[model samples]
Target: MSRNPRILVTGATGRLGRLLVPRLLARGAHVRALTREAGRAASLAADGAEVVVGDLGDGASLRHAFHGASHLFLLSPISPELAAEQIAAIAAAKAAGVQRIVKLSGSHWTIEPPGRSLSGDAHAHIEAALRASGIAHQVLRPNAWLQVTLARLAGELAAGDVLHAPPAFPKVAGIDARDIADVAAHALLGPEPSATDSPWVLTGARAVDHHEIARIASALSGRRIVAEPLSREALAQRAAQAESPYVAQVHAQFAALIGTGEAATVTDTVERVLGRPARTIEAFVAEALAA
Candidate 1:
């Protein structure tokens, strides 16, 4: 019998990472999870993952985590240093003799006229670096996360019927993070690397506008939810109130992309890889609310 691959999973405490770890465990892959905080990794350790305390910025820590691992699932938190962090991780994986790396990249990262989206530009740079490294790699570029939208607007959805946000013009086929995790698990544990170097664009079953989202929210929450389009300035003000100015700026840029209909494209990558339909936004909202 062939032995299961030893996989090193970065961002193991993150939204997708948390889900992917258990799925990998279920598949009988030997999983090692890297996290900065050992305290936060206790639950993953309990779930049979070999948790390693490591910082993506710290070369020594990442080298230690990558040691003896045959495969790697590379994901890092969004930050100004995202590109640097991922590149460092890739270098560490290569030095440790990891055979393959499945990186969680971003949708529209390959879009022309680069640097349009800060996050997309960073991911593109990392992808380029990965290609230069000559490592066997596959990239999964998921669209706007339904979980992020739901979490950001949870309070508004619960308190009132109005779902206020910037205009949704181009529409978005928002994907569930859990589906991304499922796909990542398959990529890490699959018998062979992807046939091509082209990144896979993962999306939900269909594109949806805010109106559709409001309707779904209403049905799920048993309340009349209305889509309220806010001005860019208004959206920025709200984001600033909730988070940092940088976050507000990023959100504004994303809103502009959505307004221009640039983010509405859907793809069959998820179903093609997993042999099952991607989870719907309605289902994600329902599960999140229940939890």
Candidate 2:
């Protein structure tokens, strides 16, 4: 009789990890959630995860958390140290004999040749470590998130009629974070991922621009909102003050290719993996407005 897979989830208290822990828990998997802050993970412990305090930068703590775990869910916030930290996690997982890893990776379109984008380069480095470790792993490459890219627009609409934002040209297939969580759960708890199909590129059902976003918001909220570009100085300031300068620089790279239509590819990965249509833009907007 085999025991249930003991999965270790890093960043378990974060946006995607918090959502994923519940999905794995609902399926009766044995889960160990790793957090740097012990005080913030009580909810995870209450949900039946063996909450353990561990830091990616602190190897001893990571090994202690990884002990006896059969699988790993790897995620972290954007930072200049992202590459080194996740690379360390991969090594720790290998030493602890963890059999599988599911890594939420940078979007595929955002990656270029080495040194092109800081975050992209970071993901690339961590992925290389995963491959070298000879562990079974799946990498999920999700596109623009509705939570980050579009949810704020709803709040701005609530404040006034006119949306103080430029009508962007790029058609982004922004995905709901819930969809991302769902796909990641499948990778972690479902059948082992094949190396040939190791990396999954995920996006929404259709592409939409800021103008379409404004149009949808108008219809949903019953308010006539117009899209207007913010000042260059304002945009630059926001990027400059971004929490992770690495992320800020990578976003600038993404901004440079906005009009080239390089990131508009929509995939059926979520549908094929989950056996349903990927959640649509309208659904995302409806939920955003409701929130």
Best of the candidates, lDDT = 2
lDDT for model 1: 0.82
Residues 65-134, candidate 2, lDDT per residue (tens digit)?
A: 8888899999998888888999999999889888989999988876645666678888988888888888
TM-score of 1: 0.90
Clashes of 2: 2
Which tens-of-lDDT digit does each residue in 115-148 have in candidate 1? 7778788899998988888788888888888877
TM-score of 2: 0.93
lDDT of each: 0.82, 0.83
Q: TM-score of each candidate?
A: 0.90, 0.93
Give the runs in model 1 whose Cα sits over 4 Å from its true position. 109-113, 152-154, 168-170, 219-223, 231-234, 241-247, 288-291
Which model scores highest in TM-score? 2
